[model samples]
Every structure is written in C-alpha cells, then in structure tokens.
Target: MTTESGAGARVNCVVDAEGRVALELPAPVAATRPHLLLRLRPKKGEPVTVSRTVPLEAVADGPARAVLEPLPALEEGRWDAFLLNGPDDTAPERLRPGLRDLRALVDGHLRDRPSPVAVRIPYVTKEGYLAVRAWLRTAHAEAGRIDVGDRSTTVTARLHGATFEDGAVVRLRMRGSDAPERDVRPVTDGDHLGFRFTVDHEDLAAGTAAEGGIWDVFVHPAAGAPPIRVARLLDDVADRKASFVHPAARAAGAVLRPYYTLDNDLSIRVATG
Candidate 1:
C-alpha cells in the first residue's frame, strides 16, 4: 500500500470494551512494516514507549488499519500516538485525532476487570494530536457522587481489586507535612460493595493553622491491603483538576474545598480566611 510522508496526517481511533485499540491512518502505510508507536509524555525522569506492528490483513484500500491488543499492558501515563511508516529509523509522524469511538469506555465495561485494572482512553490533545490516557491500578478507590454540605463533605467511592473489611477506613494525610493523619470509617454497603465517608470542614481546618494545607485522600480497603489513592479515573476526562471543581465550604474561619489533583487523585484543600 502507498503512504503519505507529510506530518499533517491524522488517525482515527476506536477502543473496544476489552481495552483493545484500533487505529486508522489518514493514508495507507507500508503493508510490510507499519507500526503504532506510543510514547509517554516526558516528565522529570525517563519516559516509556511501546510499539506494535500492524497485521497484514488489517490494511486495505482505504486508510491503513492496525490493532493494539489489550495484553502486555501499557504504563500509566499520557501516551502520544505516532505512525511509523518505514523501519525503526524512520521519523515518526504525529497523528491528529479523527472520529474517535469510545462508547464502550463510557459504558464502564472494563471496571470489573481483575486486579491491576487496566484502562486506556483515547482523546484529542489540546494541540489537536491523538493521545491516550492510561491507568494501571492494583487497588483503586474511584471517587463517585460527592455531596457538599455547609459543615462537611460526603464522598461515595467504589473499591476495585480489593474488598472492604470490618475496619475499613479512609485516611486524610496532609501533603508535605508531618501532621498526624486523620482516619474515618466509611459506611460500607454490602449490596454494592461501595462505601461513603464524610469529612468535616472544621476538622480539616483544625488540623492546620491559619495558612492551611492540602490533604491527600486514601482508602484502606482491608486490614492488610495497602492504602489505595482515592481518584476518579473511570470516565473520559483526562485531567480533572480544573474541569471538576467543587464548591468550597467555610468553617472555623477557613475555607475547605475538595478537588482533583494534577494526577487526578482526590484531595482536600484548606485555606485560612
């Protein structure tokens, strides 16, 4: 098949219920050596990359098609997709997003997967490139419906890859501080295995002086299970810090607000009045 050399090419992506990814290139790629390259967005440390070749039959007259199976999991991060038309030495072409089909992901089909729940969401980046937000969690506390009250905030969350024991508790620990941690037992409903906990704004304000601080939230699923971070990752929203804002409550001359961090982990910020 013929291929395009321009960097302005685009890719249409469709993610199945089982986390399988299908990619369609704007133009046909080399049938012999077409590949999909996923490079994790760089940070302070070294970035990770994964590559998968396209099968012969998946390509046809129209756009070149390639499928990335769910197995051999990807690292948890935002990965940018590229189209490699030639050998490994070929310059990869950045792919713009087009016609993304992610209905299965919206239906929450992978939520019941086994331990180390793997989730991959394909989306268009702010730069208009095709990228994926991935997560691999051994134990996850997915923050669900939240109710903000005058004096307290109630959070209901679902536990995955871990079961709640009799002494299950949620911990609120101050970030970058030595302050003692506060623990509150969540009322677990056996029917759905979901739990809900309430955080008092006054209690959070009392934990810190006038300056106030940020408290990271965690869930202790059982007696021996390691603490799992409370986050919201089951949906399509890649970054929730700015998109998912919550109303702040005033108590003890302080403003208490719950918000999602840059990493999408749930945290409460207390600011002195």
Candidate 2:
C-alpha cells in the first residue's frame, strides 16, 4: 500500500534475490540483515522488468544489508540509505548520503551506460518560495520530516497534500542524466495526486538524444503538486521512434517531449519550497 508521512512515502519493491519488500522512502531504508537485490540495467532490447520478490531470510542478518548493489559499511552504523534532503537532530551523514551516492551512480549510468528506462530525481527542491522538503541541509529540514539512524539514518518526506487545477502550466527539469530534449509531463488525475511532472525529450534542447546525457529541470511548484513517476516521455530520432527505457520509465510511448517547446508558459514552473 502507498502511504505518506508528511512526504515520506511507503511503496513496494522486489529484487532478484529478495522477494518483495515494503519500503517507506524519502527515508534511508536498508535491510535488517544481508543479501538483498540491486536493480540491474536491462540488456539491449530487453525489457527492464523487476517482478521478483526478495527473500527476507537472505537478508535476515549481516555486516551489510542491500539493494541493487551491496552498500559499503556506514561507520555511523547504517548499511544503506535514501533521502530527498532533510535535516535531522542527528549527524549530517545519516540524512543525505543517498544524494551523494546517487550523484556517483547517475554519473556512472550516463547515456552510454544508461538503463533502457528513466527515473525521476527524488528529493526535489524550490529556490525561493518556501523550504518544503530537504535532505542534508538542516536549516531547511524544519518544514519537512526526518528519520535518523545509528548505522544509517532515514528521513521522512514532506507531504504538502498540495494540488493544482486542470490546465495548470508546469515545468520539469531533469535531475540527472541527459536526453535529446527535456519534456515536462503533467498528468491529471483525481487520485491523491492530480497529475505528474518530470522530464523527457521535450525538457532538453532540440536534436539532443538520450544516449548519455544528464539534465535537470526547474519548475515553480505553484504550477502544481510535485510529480511522481508515470511513464517516461519517449524519443524520435531521424523519424525513427525509440522509448526511454529506464526501469522507472518501464512503460513505452505514452508521453513524449515538448508539452510545448519554447512556450515559456510554465515559468520553469518551480517554486522555492
């Protein structure tokens, strides 16, 4: 079940070795034991599917609990972590290491080595409006939530329970990796979230392809609520179409780039939360 604490998110995950694990994220989540699953990049033309349930027994105990990869020992006592950048009464390392590790991993997974899918950057931010959520910046964590750890720390997400009306203009900047173009996707629904906004081809400059590039989008949250992963926008090069295949963007060809290029309607649509 998907639950929310402030902005802390509870979702489900399954890896090869582990069966299925329920995770409360925006917080640092590691295994209670060892032996876990690390998300793998699907081979050429292979679908990026993760339907396996990780066995708890495999990770019942050990020096390192795991995910898509084995994590280095965290001296603070944590084995793994995740974050959207929030502050904690605990040490800094406990709250935001996920962002640091993510940067390194994203760099390694550039266009040349990018997965067939795309993933939206977690732990979002706004420049000036209000500090809604944070990972490592303590000054900013006040408005959000936090989860501290011994070997590691877990922070909670700041849930605004915010909303936007239909036809609200929005913008999405890619957080990591590159694409031919950056496209902002705003999907509307009546579910807890109205629509989604994240990047794809339309968000980047023209003629750029999604092989090995990194991109970030800036939006004014006033445009709408934060976006969650839906489907990644696709790519069309030389009149041939191929989809962005990151596991996060497993579904093919629903929304492609340019909600409207050069329109400047969104004001980059990001607010400083």
Best by lDDT: 1
Indicate which candidate wins on TM-score. 1
lDDT by residue (43-88, candidate 1, tens digit) is: 7686444544444233566677778789877788888888776565
lDDT of each: 0.79, 0.24
lDDT of residue 28 for candidate 2: 32
lDDT for position 245 in model 1: 89
**How much lDDT does candidate 1 score?**
0.79
Candidate 2 overall Cα lDDT vs. reference? 0.24
User: How much does candidate 1 score in TM-score?
Assistant: 0.89
Name the lDDT value of residue 72 in candidate 1: 76
Steric clashes per prediction: 0, 80
